[model samples]
Target: MDLNLRKAILSNVSGHNTEQLEATIVDAVQNGEEKMLPGLGVLFEMIWKEASEDEKQEMLETLEQSLQHNQVQ
Candidate 1:
C-alpha cells in the first residue's frame, strides 16, 4: 500500500480559497493532534517551494524564536 501523503493532502485542499486554507490550518494547529503534523509539513513544503529567499529567512527566524521560547520553559 503506497500512500502518497503529500499528494493526498494537496488533492484534499486544492482550489481552496485563502480563508478556507487559513481555517484548515487554524483547526489543525488548535487541535494539536500528532496525526496532523505530516499534513502541516506537506503544506509548509508547498509554501517553502513558493517562498522567496527573504520569506524563507523570515520563516526560519520565526521558527527559531518559537523553539527558543519553548526551550526556556
Candidate 2:
C-alpha cells in the first residue's frame, strides 16, 4: 500500500481499544473483502518486523502448518 493510505488507516485505528481492534479484524476476515487485506497486511508486517526470532519462527511454523492443512482440505 502507498504511504498515504497506510497513514490514513493507522490514523483511523489509532484510538481503537483491543476489543475494537479484534472486532475489526474479525469482520475484515469474515467479509473476505479484498480492500481490507492491504490494511491488515500492513498491520501484520509492522508486528512481524518487531517480533523476536523465536516468535518469528513460531509464526512461520504455524503458517506452514496452516498452508499444509488448507492444501489437504
What lDDT would each prediction earn against the true structure? 0.95, 0.89
- Please provide, for model 2 over 1-73, each residue's C-alpha lDDT reduced to its tens digit, 9 standing for 90 to 100: 3468878878878889999989989999999999999889877887899999999999999999999889963
TM-score of 2: 0.86
For residue 2, give model 2's deviation from the true position in Å: 8.2
Candidate 1 local lDDT, 1-73, one digit each (tens)? 9999889999999999999999999999999999999989999999999999999999999999999889964
Highest lDDT: which candidate? 1
Compute each candidate's TM-score over C-alphas.
Answer: 0.93, 0.86
Residue 24, candidate 1: alpha-carbon lDDT: 93
